[model samples]
Target chain A: MANIHDVSKAAGVSVSTVSRVLNNHPYVKKEKVEAVKKAIIETGYIPNINAVNLKKGKTHLIGIVLPFLDVPYFSQLVQGISQAASVHQYKLVLYQTGYDEHQEKEALEMLKLKQIDSLIICSRKISLETVEHYQQYGSIVLFENGEDTPLSYTFIDHYACFMRALEYLYEHGHRKIGFSVNRLEGANSSQRERAYRDFLKLKGLPFHKDYIFKKCLNIEDGERILREIAAFQERPTAILATSDQVAAGIITSSSNYELKVPRDLAVIGFDDQPIARAMQITSVNIPLYSIGQILFEQAIAVEISHKEVSTELMERSTV
Target chain B: MANIHDVSKAAGVSVSTVSRVLNNHPYVKKEKVEAVKKAIIETGYIPNINAVNLKKGKTHLIGIVLPFLDVPYFSQLVQGISQAASVHQYKLVLYQTGYDEHQEKEALEMLKLKQIDSLIICSRKISLETVEHYQQYGSIVLFENGEDTPLSYTFIDHYACFMRALEYLYEHGHRKIGFSVNRLEGANSSQRERAYRDFLKLKGLPFHKDYIFKKCLNIEDGERILREIAAFQERPTAILATSDQVAAGIITSSSNYELKVPRDLAVIGFDDQPIARAMQITSVNIPLYSIGQILFEQAIAVEISHKEVSTELMERSTV
Candidate 1:
């Protein structure tokens, strides 16, 4: 019930002096700090942390911009980030944008408004140029490749990862290949698309628009992909999924559709999550948790830097 | 950067008046509000949201205490909560305690420190007595039955759900049955354990200590359970898994161990996630997302109330 002014009055010191003690300002005399502490106890004044954070200009809170939390990739990333943040005595403020531009902008504006110390964008819909404009407000870390920009980022080589997967499928005597992506406009998806086009050109294979399945992120989407392919005149024999969930969906429902995995359709998934391991779905190990930790570190770092994380192919039976 | 004092001096108003205008206090004069706005722009004073929040005694931040985010149940709940929070213009501050008592205490301290407006404990390790001590600070919402405590809660009737699942397995003619749990000491798990015991007693079946799988949560744990069952001379005919992830793990790995699903071991999982549907595993639907939304509503509500949510068994091929 007691305010800061009450503490100051009880301490027989100026309000500013009491504030200095509260914020642990080093310049304050030892005697004044003792007096403020005694006064705080005497008045039963509960210090609002927001007040101290206002004076210190540090909230010890970081913002994480992600499209969704139920997705394994983003959830895994959040787990990693959350673990690292707890170690550093920081907490995460989640901005679930669902790839909405306005929602993403709201997160960026929070940084401008000094609501959070820094921000980590796991995945985004806003343009790089727009994100670059907010760099002066606070440290903005990206989970995707922002190498060309002046922001800190930790990214996996989607182009190379896609190319490697494509090459693996190509070497296995498969010329007709297809892939799935959550959004066609995403930066990572664009790179993946380019890689697919280049891989097809290298193999002298024609590109089919129907082969590229958009909005394929969840497990049920895999069934949808199967149905779409079942209707096709000539379906691709080898398919690359955006996530293990989608691949798991395809394999699980394949039996119902009178199809056998690998024998009828070889399926490759990204993010070697637990699902991939359990189902034996060969996938690209993205190490999302580790990437999340790096993103958090970048968010709090003073210097702007960009680092590319490595990926591995976890070979299992589904492919 | 211009401070609040600068804005006040430029506006020719008292510092308290400037703060009142910034907080949109009803007592502030309309002319003074316009003057403060003009002065804020003129002085390039970006009102720090923390300062405004401090004065208003409202942060618009709700703390969520959870063990882990990578798990499907927790992640799905968070997704639901996040969506609801966004609709109400509130952001979530995640405190991933990993079930540590000390970490849980810190989240409670944040509530007492006025860092967050309310706290939503999805799951926890702390005692109800200790949690009750902080109710005067702000609203604290629980995702488990807290009927005895003076706190708001939205809980699933785990006891009834467990009983129903046991009876369902009994009706299917499975007398020798096993079950899995993440932690023996968890509140929900304790209720589930009691329900299992009661069901066994009602059916005149013996309880086996080895039948209870401890720390069984993830997909890999399902494989561990399978390995454990294979070693047993007298194996149970059916198993009740803690989660769909665990059931999926068991079914996925069952093929490797020469075990056919329902024919060999009828498995029933909880929290009918997408993985459960994809794997055709019979599971009890917990509806975590809807519960999450209710948890958020309870967190912001002023009065303390407890509500029990219903569950259903999704009859799939595995059973």
Candidate 2:
């Protein structure tokens, strides 16, 4: 029921000041902005952005397509997107693609039909070529796992991140090191595999085929891998996991074999998740949250290009 | 650019079969569904639903207002909603309200102005009265923590759930029991506290005000609370924590004080999260994913009412 006039009157500011604040224009005094915010809250004023969107033929809704939620990796990325979207005064629509091409097609359709202003593909099953084709319809930004795409992307160097983890183990006097990965085919895992092989070769270490562990997704994966290692006659002294969950699993399950981490089998993990800290597993801290924020920021732009976020190795008690 | 007819012809079925398959209609034979699916993929067909949405004057967008993501509680619920929404051909727009009244207001305004078809308040800062006020503008289904409001809600009986936990501990020959809750003022926690006191009095056990713990949101909260309890000369022999994260924290931190669970202090947790399983903490499984599915299914409907999901006590090693 309240209007700009009521807000301005309550805040003791001019109507133009209120307008500037609502439109998010710069150069407004801090005290005046705070006053306007307080007054808006007190008066319960909601500026009618729908009217503006209607006139501009824009819904001001951005679409984000991803596989799933609840996983800390994707959820943290989404959290960053949520924060950035709210700041920009834009709403985000999440399409749970779940690696299904049909579900992904619906998200692309939302862009082509002008239902959403732009599309940010966080994860997808469709090939790069298919997504590149949708670029003509609207801005399509990606969180790419590998190299640069034809369209705009935020790239994280999985190869470099994994390499850092391996080098850290080698520097800590580890000779025989094992590797754990979630998927063998994905861009991230593919690059990580390359890094593992390359790092071992460069360091003049023997490549143990049995040390290569795959499908290490959950904590069970870590435990499963550790159990296999415990039984093997020639087990590696160090391990690099694809996820913090896997690392945490190794720590908890290691008790069964009387293996103390760093003393018996040093372990390094990817993703600095809370579990990693709680379980005391060192990891390659990827800037996934920042990547989400940066990608969303660039995705809404009229013209955009590739952006890269680097990963840092976190030192902890594990190694 | 293959159409429905081409997909049907390729699959050896009529256009209706292909259409139904594309629309995800139930009752289709398994082989027929697989054949049609293969045909669609083979033909690279994409169904055009934009025209249908335009003609029906519907956006087919559902807004989900939650406090945050990355936490298992909300993330799991959103996961369920995302799965159900996709099945029903609706897109979810996320509003990470973060218990901010202004952010929640933005979501409510989205409903009032028809930006989204309906608003699903997963968590909110606004009172039930304010939400009830918005009911006139559009459908508003809530994930309420407290008592029933005038509007529809998907209730998880926190009081009954807590009462059951207390009774279980009492049955196990535990006279002194402590309680851990996140928010003290919310409806769920308030009811939980009342149940705790009522159950204690009924069992002729003395109520110790010092045993009540608050602000137990994360694992650290559990650890901090356990540290406080360790110093207490008259610490309870048992604890019922509101979350599994907190319970895990207590267990891990207890080792520092030379304490063992079940023998030293029995701990029962709420929410059967993965951490509970990893740490072997007995907890009340709230069936959050099903709650999400059922809530979203009802939130999209024209007529909505209150629905309650029961909790199950999962007996594990800790208890």
Candidate 3:
């Protein structure tokens, strides 16, 4: 088999020049690059990374399972993860499962098959048992609560966060409160729902099924929420938006629907993103970037651990 | 070496059952899953996907190199590409290079090493000449104009698009136009600058060096632009925002500076994203999603090709 030295000799270049060309390092002379390519073809030399990774039993690649990138929440998470991954000289393989069970399984399979060194599931649709079964293969970390499952996790207390926001709205004398959610079946959403029911039960407030708005993920969904509110004879005075984008949407389009923020309707948004700060919408500060860093560390850690991240209510206008 | 059949025989199960266990398919009986694991360990069975892929000379993984995933433009592009990639059963390995030349070279090296089947450069800081040399290793596609390069590209005409937008502002009886850009020395920015100079020369308008704003990408940059414009004793009557996020920021914060849109200053945005539609910003519609689909197709195509994607001017209340 032809080696790097053989290619270098054939190309009439130094071994370092051939190495630089093979690595695609910048500032290599065009003529030398061409010569290296010609020599490589002539010698039929192949550079196989898979073979190297197989021998070491480490690919230096982490698999990230996310649902969608267009959402600011997910994008922000990815941003944090990418920043952390780059700092450690690791690359990420994105499995955009779109909340599909089979797609999520493929990510787990990659871990079992040793295609990736570790798996970080930002969100998932697969059962806990199935995910736990693959723990013997490689390190796996979760972004949500992994209670009693023996898996490492970094989580925010969604129920506590929702309860605090709801209580704040109630203290202000706004009994009719509504909230928006994406994926009513999601683990986080289910926690928020449990908090909503418990809050209503404790406060002696009416349980209106109409108060919970589903499929509210982006800014455009705010307009839909307001339109629904406008048509209702009795509307909620305050609402919890799924994201800052949705909160900004409701406030920006408030006048079009003949409503005033905090007067006609108050809004509390999640993920105190830039838009929330720019628009002065009160939001819950979920440090997704810091969380992403913690998740990455957990994915590489030898011991199984769970980290509970805290949240803060960023009070601004609109509430 | 023990294979799937050998493990199945040891586990007292069918080969398909062992296969299902190896793939981590959901809904498998927990007892069978445990039995399969024990059998595999006892038999020293190894399921090497890399070895299988090495023989086929295909990894079924596409690499996407970009500067940032948090940006809406890149995320939306990734969204489209991911949808297309899923249809083709290809996973994506993301290289968040942050426009570092060395990091960009790493992606190219992965192609030469056959770690990724093809690469899609959504945005880059590396020279086109350096990138073109990697075509022999694998299919390389770009999201920018690859003029005179023997590479596949899907691009928007930034010069023509800028000129048309400048003309629209001129027809509206506004001169002394300004524009914002993410990177002043970027290829697209240079084209837009050339168009700006030509537009001003055609109309016999004077150019103000202070009129151009650099490092403007997100919504927060809008406030910075407005503050700078407000500080100017004599400001341009119109401006071209780099993105809808920047434009939304400008318009949303204009009232704080006591400046009204179109009355005090006319504004135009790029990429008619959802925020543009919600905020009614007149923007040049760059169909990034459709362009993403084309870029993915080019990445897998056998032949080299170049595609110039058309842009549309979406008129709204801003102009």
lDDT of 3 by residue, A1-319 (tens): 5667799999999988987887779999999999999999999887778766765678888999999999888988988888899888888898998899999999999998888999999998899899999898899999999987889999999999999999999998899999999989999999999999999999999988899999998879988898888888889999999999888778878898888889989999999988887788899999999998889888888999999999999999888
True contacts kept of each: 0.92, 0.43, 0.77
Structure candidate 3, residue pairs in collision: none
Candidate 1: regions farther than 4 A off: A8-14, A20-39, B5-43
lDDT of 2 at B256: 80
| TM-score of the B chain in each candidate versus the native B chain | 0.92, 0.81, 0.88
**Candidate 2 segments exceeding 4 Å error:** A1-54, A145-147, A227-233, A303-305, B1-55, B145-147, B231-233
Give the TM-score of each candidate. 0.95, 0.80, 0.89
Native-to-model Cα distance after best TM-score fit, residue B182 in candidate 1, in Å:
0.2
Cα deviation of B219, candidate 1, in Å? 0.3
lDDT of 3 by residue, B1-319 (tens): 5767799999999988987887788988999999999999999887877765765678888999999999889999998999899999998899999899999999999999888999999988999889988888899998888877888898889999999999999999988889999998888998999999999899999999999999999999988999999999999888899999899888888999899998998889999988898888999998888887888889898998999999999999887
Judged by TM-score, which candidate is best? Answer: 1
Comparison by DockQ, 1 against 3, better one? 1
- lDDT by residue (B167-259, candidate 1, tens digit) is 999999899999999998999999999999999999899999999999999999999999999999999999999999999888888887788
Candidate 3 positional error at B105, Å: 0.7
- A229-261 per-residue lDDT for model 1 (tens digits): 989999899899999999988898888778888
Report the lDDT tens digits of candidate 2 across residue range A1-319. Answer: 5777899999999998998898788999999999999999999876544444533547778899988887778888888888888889888899888779888988897887667888988877787888888987778988875244667788888888788788888889999999888668766778889998999889888888999899887777888988999899988999998788788788878888889898999998888987776666798887777888898888788776777788888899899
Query: C-alpha displacement of B188 in model 3, angstroms?
Result: 1.1
Q: Lowest lDDT 10-mer window, candidate 3 chain B? A: B48-57
What is the descending TM-score order?
Answer: 1, 3, 2
